[model samples]
Target: MVWRQHRIIRLNIVVLLYLMVCFVLCPVSAMTVSSPAEVHSVRGNAVTLTCTFTSTSRATSRMSVDWSYRPQTGGPPQAFFHFSSLAFPPQDGQFNGRVKWLGSPARGEASIQLLNASLSDNGTYTCSVRNPPDVHGSPTSQTVLTVTPKVPTVRFSDVAVLLAFILLPSAIITLALLGRMCCPPRDKSQTQGYHSPIEVTPGDEPGFKQINRKEKNMTCCDLYFLVWPFFFFCS
Candidate 1:
């Protein structure tokens, strides 16, 4: 009978422990943090590093957020931003006057914005959220940030070169085609002038014979020279 009573007491203790865990400890095990895996931004623009958290309890002023950055050159990470009841951005450093808190704990947002991003801002960033009684799961999340340099502006000289190489040739071809269509070439057969026969002597030069102009096959240039003298004398 004594052994039976001892077993009953052990069973009661186990039931009480299970009740305490279900009511008090389960909520703390539900806290979790999350962030984006990567973010891309251009230089001279604003970029946001978004972070969020899930908690079974309501947020309070005692909760805190911490943001840290690690340079690409490989070194220890540095804390650049912090928040509790108020924001605490770096006062004098790479992130001075450039980082702002745009988060609302009631809405589960813990995002931070960086203005006028530069190439030096490319690195890894970490966000940590800590709330009492709900810190069982991981409270830190990391993101890789890549800041691309701004593209160079086009210059007048480049535009001129492009026009010379591409636009000029295309314009010339178009104009040539328009000219051919508007002013068709004159027919060479219509311009063929009649030539009179010429008197010629053979090797002895004693006899004279008339040679046909068609047999001579005179070119246009020869006919022009022949007619130019006659025109000059008549004028």
Candidate 2:
């Protein structure tokens, strides 16, 4: 009987050891971070960070997920979210009135949306899951949240109107100046073959014809008037 009892005890120890090994090798049922390892948002805009997790256990609804922030410089983590009794606390200072839970917790959803984001929201965010003594302490998964300032854009219509108002007159003036410089007007008398008459010497009169002063004056005046149109056009 003594030998039998000893064998039974040894068998029980071996079985217990086997059970311990199995438990050690089994994976933990917990949430995991799956999306948005790095996220970006612009000031005055909305942003959503996503996290997906799965568990083999059936007590997922009873689990709690926590979201917190830790500076890259290292310090105590700041709490941004917590789930318990189906309630979440008011948003922290800069985030107040701008943060919201995306959906219900029972579905393993832990996404959060931030509204009217600002520069102060930049930090490292950590998501953790807890299910009490049945599981080990919640493991932390981190993401970097970066806030970028929005760039101002000019509308097409506004740009077109501005160009018309500011550049149109300047362009016209430039073209007029260029035209005047490139093609200058010639004197009318020279262009029309009208020249002042020269007086002939008494001895040389046989070779050249003499012109009357009145006729010469009249011809010069006519040529001047004829060239007036070209001068006016250039001006």
Candidate number with greatest lDDT = 1
Q: TM-scores of all models?
A: 0.58, 0.58
For residues 6-74, what per-residue lDDT tens digits would candidate 1 score against the true structure? Answer: 999999999999999888855545578899999999999999999999887789998899999999887
How many pairs collide in each candidate, listed in order?
0, 0
Candidate 2 Cα outliers beyond 4 Å, as residue runs: 1-31, 59-61, 131-138, 176-235
lDDT string for model 2 (36-134, tens) is: 689988988999867655544544557777788777567888887777646485555665677687745556566778788888778888777655433
Inter-residue clash pairs, candidate 1: none
lDDT of each: 0.81, 0.66
